[model samples]
Structure formats: C-alpha cells, structure tokens
Target: MLDLIASLLADKELDCRLDHPITEARAAFNRAIAEKKTGPIKRLLVEDAVLVTGTDSGVISGRDAQVEVWRADFAQAGRFVYVRTPRCVLPSEEEPIVTELGTWVGKPEKADGSEVRGDYTAKWREVEGKWKLEAEIFTTVKSRDALAL
Candidate 1:
C-alpha cells in the first residue's frame, strides 16, 4: 500500500490518471478511520474543517488548523481522497522546490465560472503495516489572471 501511495504521488508528474490514487487514498484513510488508527492528528470532517486562501481573506494558522481547511474543501468538493506527497530525492538527485509542504496545485473548471486553484498535502505514516494519513491540508491561491473569464 505504501508503494502504491508512493506511485500515486509521483503520478502527478507522470500524467497518469489521478482517480486511482484518489480512490486508494480514500480507501486507506477510511480503513484507518474505521480501525481507529488515524491517530490524534486526524479527525472526521464534521469535527473540524475549513479553507485557507490568499484572496479569500481566510487563513489556517498551523498544521492542525490546516487539516480543518482540507476537511472543508473535501466536503464541499467530491470525496475522493487526493494527496500530493513530498518528492524524495537521493543525494545525487535534484528535488522540486515547492513553497509549502505537501502542496499540490490543480484547477478544474467549476460550473460557476470560477477557477479554483489550490495546493494540498498529506502526512502519512506506517501504521500496522499500512500507510495512514496523519495530517492533510489545502490552501487556495487566488489570482486576477486566473479568475479572469
């Protein structure tokens, strides 16, 4: 499962279908929740959730607070679990420098005629031989160019 998760993370660059990764991530997270293995860092969306954005004037202070932002986004959007993980690099390899941790930027046209571009990241740990997301976050990025329609 860890290997699958790793592949899914890299698939963003490979241009592979993201649905598989999202599905797997969702199932893995659900299982973790069911088994009560998500740890203190993770909680259901209803318990806490919010959305942080640059232009929206909303902000999530810290790590746990960011989780709430992610929860809200996931709830408002579809429920497929999508995560953009850290790219690991060997000493001889160069890594991509992302401004934020576990941040993924994607924009799919919304029916309302607004572009939603955001970055998301997930923290995962090996628990009981399976990788579970301990923390996850989403931050919205706003731009006049992006919003121009």
Candidate 2:
C-alpha cells in the first residue's frame, strides 16, 4: 500500500511538472495579446508558426506573415482585449507536443463596439525546453444578430 501511494504521488508530481510551463506560456501569450505587445507575442511563437483567422481571412503562414497581420490589426485597434480559456490541454502520447482547445473572445477597440467570440485550437511544441506555439486555428461563433442579418 505504501508503494502504491508513493507511485500515485509521483504520477501527480510528474503531471504538474509538465503542465506548469504550458500554463506559463499560455499566460504570457494572453498577456502579450491583451497589452498589444508585439515583441512578446512574437517571442512566444515559433519562427514558422501558422495562424489561421476566422471571418474569411485566409491562412497566414510563417511567423513573419502572422506578425505583420497582427501589427496592422493592432495599429488600428484603439484598445484590444483578448481572452482565452483552455477547455482541454491534451498531451500527445507519442510526441513532445500538446494541443489546447479553448474558447476565445476578442473585443477590438472599435467605435461600433464589435466583439468576436470563438473557439481556438493551438498546437504547442517544446522547443529547447520552452513551449512555443506552433500553429493555431480559430473559428468565430456567430451571434444571433449576425444570423438574423
């Protein structure tokens, strides 16, 4: 019984150890987006990260392309707020990768006060002992008003 208890405790400890860095990376990414800090956001992403935006926006391949798109968007945004809550952080059974599925809401600083709520899935890769976003895809949840229109 003591050995079993010890084994359980060790498993729990391992889980926490693996999860801590991913949680930190997620927080840092969200903070960068909320503060519109381009440098931090770029740093959190892999050099070849891919970002797919909703609303008919085409796939943005490569980190530089993604950064440029965000730069333009942030420039016009008076105040931008982005929120993401991870529904699941699943670790790959075979690879050094994790996938996160989350709900996200973004309110751009627009005079009309438009908001976008959606679900996003992101793939994170452990690169040199750091978790970096490798790719992300977002889909918007249409509001009742949008459906009516």
- Put down candidate 1 lDDT per residue, 73-142, tens digits, no spaces: 5555422233244333111123221111333333332333434444554434334444334444565554
Candidate number achieving the greatest lDDT relative to the actual structure: 2
Worst 10 residues of 2 by lDDT: 12-21
Tell me the spans in candidate 1 whose CA falls farther than 4 Å from its real position. Answer: 1-23, 26-110, 143-148
Which candidate wins on TM-score? 2
Q: lDDT of each prediction vs. the true structure?
A: 0.40, 0.73
Model 2 clashing residue pairs (backbone): none
TM-score of 2: 0.76
Q: Sum up the clashes in candidate 1.
A: 4
Candidate 1 backbone collisions, by pair: 50-68, 50-69, 102-121, 104-120
Q: Which ten residues in a row have the lowest lDDT in candidate 1?
A: 89-98
